[model samples]
Target: MYVFSAQRRAISIICIYMTYPYTTWQNCVYSIDRR
Candidate 1:
């Protein structure tokens, strides 16, 4: 159970790391579209 929980945490961290940049890029594009 502990290992499973650790894996879940790692996946969550990786997902956040991956999404953070994409989300920022999306926001940047959205702002550009507004201009």
Candidate 2:
């Protein structure tokens, strides 16, 4: 159970980094530029 919890924590951290706020900010900029 401890190992599974650790694995899930690692995966969550990875997912957070993969779709980080900076990437979303860049997408927002592109949309603003289109205006």
Q: Score each candidate by Cα lDDT.
A: 0.54, 0.53
lDDT of 1 by residue, 1-35 (tens): 13436655565556566678676544543454466
Summarize candidate 2's per-residue lDDT along 1-35 as a digit string, tens digits. Answer: 13446655565556557657655534543454466
Q: Which candidate number has the best lDDT?
A: 1
Which pairs clash in the backbone of model 1? Answer: none
Which residue segments of model 1 deviate by more than 4 Å? 1-4, 23-35
Prediction 1 TM-score vs. true: 0.43
